[model samples]
Target: MHRFNAYRIFEKEGQVSARLVELGIDDLDPGEVLIRNSHSSVNYKDALAATGTGRVVRRFPVIGGVDVAGVVVTSGDTRFWEGEAVLVTGYGMGVEHDGGYAEYSRVPADWVVPLPLEMSSADAMAIGTAGFTAALAIMRMEQNGLKPANGPVVVVGASGGVGSVAVDLLAGLGYEVTAISGKDDQHEYMRHLGASQVLSRHTLEMGKKPLEKTIWAGAVDPVGGEMLAWLTRTMKQDGTIASCGLAAGIELHTTVMPFILRGISLLGIDSVQCPMALRRSVWERLASDMRPRHLKEMTRTIHFEQLPETFDALLKGAVKGRVVVEIQA
Candidate 1:
């Protein structure tokens, strides 16, 4: 009986289509916690789900958003109660289940994270999966012995969501950050997020050697492929690289010289299906040490009706930073 607005994607005969339509509560997937979705952030995966370009959605008629934050309206689980703010991210949202591109979302209680004490619903999604991924990358680097004093850290695709957040978080932690981006327009924005320097993406392109000059102590890479290959070879001896995203491409073509000779580690990061315990810790840390100083500046708010156009822009890389959809409106 509870009708709401939703962006639903359906696949028929191997073809996918999506549209914003009206649906009722009974149409949603079964779950214990019902969220009145206030905000959901855009991710590259969301674009894939919305447009069906990557076969991301494992099921038909799925909602397409991987992150959501809002107040709980009702709950079947005792661990949560009415009026409590919460967030949901990763774990195949928009890919394998109904997700946050709607005015309401019903998800398993276990998938919910109590919003950090210091973070508001808007701020929670402003960080979204991208910032969470950035936090995870930092955590991975730390576990691999990366320290602020080790030297400068580099973030590739630095104007995009994951890279922007990584740049800000690394710089906030007192590590010098070199941002690699082709969008010259983002230079000042990167600086505002605490980047020590911004390098053109062209600087990392073909240099005709298996190994190049070593400069970075470590790197947070979202633009894999050649950028990852370059980072692998150019990192300082014993350095590590937290590899996430394949915006560039999935294949990594390179020699093993960096790993064998330099002892550099290529650490892969996956926000989806990240352990619940680590998920909670990473989010808590996002409100603390990993919180970017300019998170507000990096977020743009749009309403539910605006999702389609924005999704297109995000896929074309025409949008920068984070985009939070005000689903309820």
Candidate 2:
């Protein structure tokens, strides 16, 4: 391709700015696979990187998207073939390297995952990095003895990308899901995604006791901060909490009583550098059993031109569900 549109962020003179510019293939980083990017997703990290509200981009003048799903146009590695559908996330993507907010993305073959047979390009991006992180969190919890029969699973920050997908996946797997969100208007929407009950964020503020009344069996926590601390205090014995995003805050002020006294497990989820085996497994499960029934309802599609406004909405917490960027459309 001679030229294609990409949203690039540049930091100069201590000011960060982003723009959609036309660039040639030479602008992309070196890699084994070249993808004719079809779709990308707006993640919290993507919002941070594009808006420069946070230090999400370690490199300047880089494309600003963390996830991409599309067709491989060429591949030097034998593991992937031309015309094969693939997806790439994490592993320095959209962080230290150029990423998917473009008409094309050239990435290492090792970073590319062949799209699951059951998933389409749009579907793959719909469940992009945010959904992948949620799936990883649930998978870790399951490995640590979390079962639907055990009890209800609470999803903190339940209206955002990661939290919404977590709620949908857990609910689809027959787990009674309780969604906690600050958005009062989204309570009904949360229930539609299979949450058996919806709780306001204020419900988590049950005082800063080292331990509290045990109510949940497992939790998919993307909110972090005090919400995680509260979940720690209120979890049943042997309960597991998957700590993912820090939408609320990063600091955790709590005692170790939950871990020491109750054998509570805190599984930190890092999707960026997750093992390839696990990454493939998670995507497969997402295409199969863990697939969200309400994916269409939980996602909103936008053209590449909408990224700036979308990022603003995401940063303001005004976006509901996942925001998929249609690169080809």
Candidate 3:
């Protein structure tokens, strides 16, 4: 195709603007693989980048999508071949590089992951980077000695994409899950995702002590800040906390008592710049047993034209679960 539709973000008058535009292949950044992108998904980071609400995009005039899955149309790398199913996520995508909110994406070979046999492009995107991060969190927690027999796993921000997937994966793995969210309406939705119990965000009151009740054996925290501090205090001895996003806030004001006295581990999860070997392993797990059973139910698919409106919803915290963007018919 000589030209295709893409959602481009541009900086003008010191303000960022985004729109659907027509662009040619040459407009894409030089890369080894040219993918006919079928689906991409909106993460919290994508919303930040698209709306310029945060310093998510370092460079101007980039596509705003962190996750992409499609068919490889051309390949300069020996490991990838034409017509092979593949995906690209993270590693400066939609930030410093042109991303997946388009009909086509040309990205570096190192950033491309061959889609697993059990996963379709749409399915891969349905999970997307959000799910990938959730899986990575679980993997790291497990490596740190967390197990189904340990106790309960609490998922903060449990109504969002990453949180919902974390709930499902942890429950599917035989761990009891307590989902915590600020949205009152999402209680039933979180339960359906296999959360044994759903708690309001307010229920996790900030205790003024260095340590609180040891309730959680592990936690998948995307809503950092005070919530993370709370988790750190309430975790069981030797428990692990996989900290991801900062939907609540970024600051963590807490004493070192939990880490020193309880030996609790705080694992930082960064989907971007995650090593390829671990990335492949995580994707493979997501395509298999760790995949959310309610994958389709947990996702909302929209076209590329709907991104502007969707970005607003995502930024305002109105969108729930995953928002998958269909890049092709």
Q: Show how many residue pairs clash in every candidate, following the order shown.
A: 0, 0, 0
Candidate RMSDs in Å, in order, are 1.3, 0.9, 0.8
Q: What is the TM-score of each candidate against the true structure?
A: 0.97, 0.98, 0.99
Candidate order by TM-score, decreasing, is: 3, 2, 1
Candidate 1 per-residue lDDT over residues 1-329, each given as its tens digit: 56888888888888888888898988889899999988898888888888888888998889889999998989999988999999999986888889998889999999999999989888888889998999999999999999999999999989999988998899889999999898887899998888988888865465757888899898999889888888887989999999989989899988988889999999999999899899999998988877778888988998777777887988888889988887763
Q: lDDT score of model 2?
A: 0.92
Give the per-residue lDDT digits (tens) of candidate 3, residues 119-215.
9989889899999999999999999999999999999999999998999899999999999999999899999999999999866576889999899
Candidate 2 segments whose C-alpha is farther than 4 A from its true place = none
In order, the Cα lDDT scores of the candidates are: 0.88, 0.92, 0.92
Q: Write the per-residue lDDT of candidate 2 for residues 100-186, one digit (tens) a residue.
A: 999999998889999999999999999999999999999999999999898999998899999999999999998999999999999
Q: What TM-score does candidate 2 get on C-alpha atoms? A: 0.98
Q: TM-score for model 1?
A: 0.97
Displacement of the residue 190 alpha carbon in candidate 2, Å = 0.6
Q: What is the Å distance of residue 244 in model 3 from its true position? A: 0.4
